[model samples]
Target: MGYLRLLRQRPILVLWSSAALSVLGDRLYGLAIMWVVYEATGSAVWMGIAAVVESLPYILIGTFGRGLIARFSSFGALGWLDAGRAVVACAVPLLWSPGQGGITVLLVLVLLLGTLGVLFDPNLGGLVPDLVRPDRVREVTALLDLTNRIAVIAGPGCVGLILMVVSEVQLFAIDGVTFIVSAAAMWWLRAHTHRVARAAAPGAVTAPARRAEPVAAWPVLRRHPDVAVAVGLHGIGFFVAAVSAVGLPTLLAVRLGQGAAGYGLALSAVGAGALAGNLLIGNLRAGRWLTVYCSAWTVTGLALIGYSTAPTLPVVLGVGFAAGLAAPAAAVTLRTKLAGFVPAQRLRLITVDQTVIRTAGTVGMLTLPVAVDAAPATTFAGAGLLLIAAAATAAATGRRVTAAAIMSSREPAGSQTS
Candidate 1:
């Protein structure tokens, strides 16, 4: 009853529901675009170029967009972003034909979407602390992660069914509708909620203004070495994830002698496992977070090694599941630690921190191709060993601020003591 009661609260419910729908739409849109591109162009090179264009905004805008986000009302910014994306998604199908420079048009649209997404992302991260009670941040973060995992697991199957009955253009129409719904939900949440003072008196003292000189992110991170280390550990986890994502199909096709079905199953297993992991992490108290964080990576590293050597589809699936289970602990713990370590005043910097983490995944993915020429087993094993080292590094750094200490500093006002 209590959990359901919490879920019924308008802001939380609307934000979470909208996020889930948005993620599902993104998955569907991505699949449709890739399929359409390949079908129309009949060239893998074009697909690669599309992928690079899609990724450029994160790399470019993520570095420069934080200041712009910090200047606006995060909730309003997020709503406008959703609205803008909805417009773009709707316009995409109207502007394209198979042979008339469709690839160029797709690339431009993808770039625009990525730019909007980059601008939206940090503001969204900045909004979380304001939206929920201090103690609920970790749980909310984990829940968000769970929604994404669910989308990843179910999106392909949903796409398969949709494609059986509708054109890709029609499926994109559905995607546009999802964004419109998400934008509506965001607007509703904004209308119903205040960033601060849900229950304060009309004449309560307002907080002091931020400094004229913006707080430098690098200095703040330098002062909190633990935060930096935790971020790096998070990045390492992401790196492993990126590598596996790129490498799994190769392993299935070349080593295990399976095809698309096998790859899909393996991916499904990973997503399911990640969902389970996030559920477990969400319910866990702070006292156990560090232990879980360290152990999860250790297990994930071992799972990667296991996956590398798996001789059959079942074994590979099992290994993928195990790795998935371990993945969320590192992510959730690190994020929780961040919420504990970073002061409310500096919380906007979280976007920058997260940008680095995402970049780490890109770095891992880029490096993976270099090793693709090596045996699959050898490449995976090496990646596993690097993650194991990352686990050890996280544990070593974690001793500086125990989870108990983090729990004690959960207050929203001055949580930066970590």
Candidate 2:
């Protein structure tokens, strides 16, 4: 009911619609390109290269390009980026050939799309708080997360049906159309709303003069230690998640003697759990965000540990479902907390968060495979234990920070009478 109420508002409706379309399109594009690349090359190595090339931009841009991203954290700029992606998506089929030259061109296009994505993703996170009433930020965030979960669940199936009737290349064209539609919706929002502009305007009181200067995220994060802790823990969580991503299938094969079908069921369970979590969070009023965030990670860690000991497919699915359920609570709360910062610092902080997550995931992907191969169950349990420890540390640190701040506030201003 709450999600339905939020969806009725025109701006929220438009924004949600665009997000749904764009995210689904992204899924289509990603699967299509990977399929096309592997088909053309018949090499897993090329597929791996393509995946790395696509993910590398997030790390690069998030680490070094925060200021540039801040400057373009506007609806119009975001719309243009979507438009650019549409062109790039459409060009893949038109320009690609069946040789190494074509594969090279496809990788280049993928890289370009990824770069644009890095620019667009954090800015969108920063934009959501500007688009809605402050009380509804969490709800909108949940809605967005829900959209992504739905896309993850349905995108592949949709692609499967499409591939039965059309070539993989045509999926890019459909993805292109979705981007164009999203761009149009964004531009409409730009024409209708002034909150973001007013908040960012130089003369506005909320937009401090200091905001014009490029503020580094580190100093800003240092000033807000809780957010810093959340960001750190989020990275650790992603690292653990990457380990599970690689280990889960292997576990299913060796332990349960299952293959793709089991893996698919596990994924669907997670998606279903995530969808339920989003709906629950979206309907409820906001609570202590940091506590919810930490607790979610703790539960996630427990779920990972559960995965290691799951003896049957049903048990594995249950563990997967629990992990998925916790993910959205952690993610939505973290974003809701990040929304509390000023626009300039908010975008930069989000960029830093994204950078940390992407970097951790990349490292996990590269370094965890051998460990996973040697000991899948141990890897799962170990990663789970590490995540739980990180969550506890973050919670303890947050408590100390809160206590110190309170004590400082209570102290006399001029107590040194001597």
Candidate 3:
């Protein structure tokens, strides 16, 4: 009650609640959709294709999506985008089969879902700090991380239980309703309007109004060496996760003959471990970005290689726990970097750039089936090698660059106070 009273100074609770609701539904539908596709066709290749379709849109609209967030109201853009996701999620069941029409429809829907997701994150990334106390950013981020892990843990298990009775279509429809409910909540959230400044002074110059504010994000990033390095390292780190996240699930369920329930159960271990790590070790004042970030990613890569050879449920579950714990810690550090760089108004644009980086790793995931086919032993080994290289490069470059600037850096300046 006391914390709620403090947070009540802004509508951070209401907005974050809406986020939790929508993301929970989104994750549930995602697990259901992936398993349903694998079930219908029994094809690992299509699973990879579906994963590609989902991430490819962010690659395509990476810049344009950022521009939209920067140009419009974050609340308005994200609310409508979440509503739009509800519409597309409903159509997922219609493409459950693996025939020509089924694959095409499913791929199309994946594209739509991914595009909407690209729009969703940037707007929301810019929105969150607006609602919370600035000093509480690490706290809010940790809570949000915890919330998302809870969703991942709970959601797949829910789908596993539901799959015993209802069809995937029913699950998809239920997810749609959840999104609609979430969007309604978001629409009602009392966020500080971006246009308030323009309204107050009528002379405020927005990002778009400034002719010098360019669209090329690479240059924007270059001005801040540490931030650019961090973002780039995030892109590389995602490759390791892609293989583990996308490849392992398919390998377990579709290739190994463990049903979707088995796959979800193993993944839930990941969510559970991540929830524990973030809650326990990822305190704002305790984390050592250089040491923790480097060692964690190295260990995560090794775990992925070990997972490729996991023969039993116990091994996979153990690997999942390690990977999940390390991955989120790394992600938290990158997000902290994001908070320090760009202005609050343009953070949306930067998030779009982040989406692009993740998509690059998805491209690696898309190639997994081909690699698996070529040399089963070699593929996993290659992923491990790449992971080490990426972590090494980032530690050598980004960590060193930022260490000197740590004391001086702060979250972006904005119209509103923390």
Q: What is the lDDT of residue 56 in candidate 2?
A: 89
Which numbered prediction scores highest in TM-score against the true structure? 2
Name the runs in model 3 displaced over 4 angstroms. Answer: 1-10, 35-43, 91-99, 191-215, 246-268, 281-284, 287-291, 305-319, 342-349, 373-378, 399-418
Per-candidate clash tally: 0, 0, 0
User: What lDDT does the true structure give each of the candidates?
Assistant: 0.73, 0.85, 0.66
Ordered list by TM-score, greatest first: 2, 1, 3
lDDT tens digits, residues 299-385, model 2?
A: 999998998899999998998888888888998899888888888877888889998998888788778878999999899899999
Q: How does each model score on TM-score? A: 0.86, 0.92, 0.77
Q: Which candidate is the best by lDDT?
A: 2
Residue ranges of candidate 2 with Cα displaced over 4 Å = 194-214, 405-418
Residue-wise C-alpha lDDT for candidate 1, range 42-135, written one tens digit per residue: 9866766777677777876667755555654346556788888888888788987787497778779888888887777655665665567787
Model 1 stretches astray by more than 4 angstroms = 1-5, 195-199, 203-214, 288-291, 341-347, 398-418
